[model samples]
Target: MNELPSRAHRPVRVLRVLASRHADSTRMVRPQDFDTELVAQAASVSDVDGHERYVPLCVDWRDARLLLSRWDDDCAMSDVPFLYQRQRRTATHLLAVPFEQLDAPGRAARMTPTFIFSIGRCGSTLLSRLLAAVGEQSVSEPDVLTSVAHFDDDAERAAAQGARERIVQSCVAAFEPACGPAPVIKLRARCNRAIDVFLNAMPHARYVFMCRDRDDWVRSSSRAFGDSGEALAELLKASVEAFDRMHAARVDPVLVWYEDLLADPVRALRRILLARDDLDARRAAVERALRTDAQEGSGLSRASLAMRTGDAGALAAFGARWREIRPERLLREHGLSRLR
Candidate 1:
């Protein structure tokens, strides 16, 4: 097991380690999960800007509140590729806000965010970094959003659909003030499951879909997450369903291919930015982003995966399985034929 960072408070560090060790557990985080002493010791704030500084660490739907932790000033949320990891290592002061408190009149008018959605192992993180480099405040995969996406109880999820939508809006709204007028947020790949929730919550927000070729995606996912072929197939099917839902909602999201991004990132950035000017700055930003590994130092980093050997047999088996189960018609219908 890896050693816990010394910077994190001892109780939070222990809890994080325990959570990581029990990664397969379906348990939801509750107020009781944290040390009461630590929670009491942490400073509390009621204003919106305070909430912005203390990003939503996780959502406690059963309790109808969010667990927020103050972010370190030294590292901007956009600069940290993995939000959860950073929080785990650095969070000290914690705050809990009720769902209703997040709601305010005219809150919706305050900011409009740009969302980057993707299949995992794609270049969405790189896109985020490039946007940040070009002076766009961007957050890559905040855990609060992931908690909502992976909310496991079917009955609770259905019952709290409206609340969930509000929670999504509130969280994004909290991020906007600190992130600038037009903030860019890159969500975890599995967030495709709750794309509808986001669409309904932030109707004015622009959406971008980042994707990779089918074979390469499977290989990358296997290498990174060790997901089986069947799992990858399910993810693809879910993405297809999400795309269909977006179209039904009358949203025409900008599509960005991972292959094209690698081939000519400046062109890709230009398309996503929808800007004809600033070519020189965009080129410099892309070049800087390309030199750095977007996910470096995190669990999903290539360096971490380098310790484990890739299985060729598993890759071949996944290929065969995917070819048999691929959503061929849906792929073509949704302009995702290249993925097939």
Candidate 2:
């Protein structure tokens, strides 16, 4: 097995050093202030001619900066199971742009993008891959949006609301030149907390909500993460509440259940497609996508997750615990009686 790095050389410590330097100075970072080799690998935003190849990987909210990684092609981005993993593996040089300086012209007027929100373990990744296979520019789980979702400080988050919204808009716009006319973005499961920010940023965007049955979701989550039954129940509770808010919102989202999606994926695709003019042409692509594992090379792949021993007793306990914390009435109110 590969040995872990020493504590002093860990990523968290390195980030802390950078953050300390950033916090102390208002001026732009200089090569001498940090590791020369690392600085040499950083790119200036102005040096890049086009935005299409640069993807927003994450946000350093403390310093109010967004990190963009350069991707060589769409294949480099889409082939990976998740955008963050692609960044970790292939991003040799990065561009850090201040939130105030980031801009995408005509962003407000551009055709609204499509969003895929889910409670996870619910075929969202499969849907994303299927869309990509069909020639759609499907972006799966970009970290920047997740950062915004888990900003953590209420006062700071409230103060930076406008900047946060702009960052969200700019990040979406950055993908347009290559992924347009409408890029479909699949958000991380926890990202639903900031769903309002996305909705407010792009009022006209289409939304698709994906979810699975409560018992299956809890079981899958527990098995995938090896977490306790209680922990999984809490996550389920939070996720369902977020879904409830979105479902009751002014924008009507296309609701897809995992069972129904697996039953008839083409039907689900048809519902999500803005126009069915090319549905017939994309049918084979969808079938091909279904044949393959969407999370194949990622840590979350089925083969990788299968290495963990399943605990039947734990799953049974989760089912009993879920009943105690059940949102059955909430599901019924949102027309999710099927989930109940």
The best candidate by TM-score is 1
- State the lDDT of candidate 2 residue by residue for 1-340, as single tens digits: 1111122211111121131123222122222232212343223355455445677767766555667766764464656678766564555445666554566535744767888998878889998998888777888887777776775577646545556677778788777766775888998887777777777677678888888887777667777766677766666667677767666676788888888877887788889985866877787888889899999877778898788665566667776777788698887777776555
| lDDT scores of the candidates, listed in order | 0.71, 0.68
Give residue 100's lDDT in candidate 1 (0 to 100): 50
Clashes of 1: 0
Model 1: per-residue lDDT, tens digit, 228-288? 8777877877887787777777767888888898898778778867744786656776787
Considering only N, C-alpha and C atoms within 3 Å, which residue pairs clash in candidate 1? Answer: none
Judge candidate 2 against the unseen true structure and give its global Cα lDDT, from 0 to 1: 0.68
Clashes of each: 0, 0
Name the regions of candidate 1 deviating beyond 4 angstroms: 1-33, 36-52, 154-159, 311-313, 320-325
Candidate 2: the clashing residue pairs are none
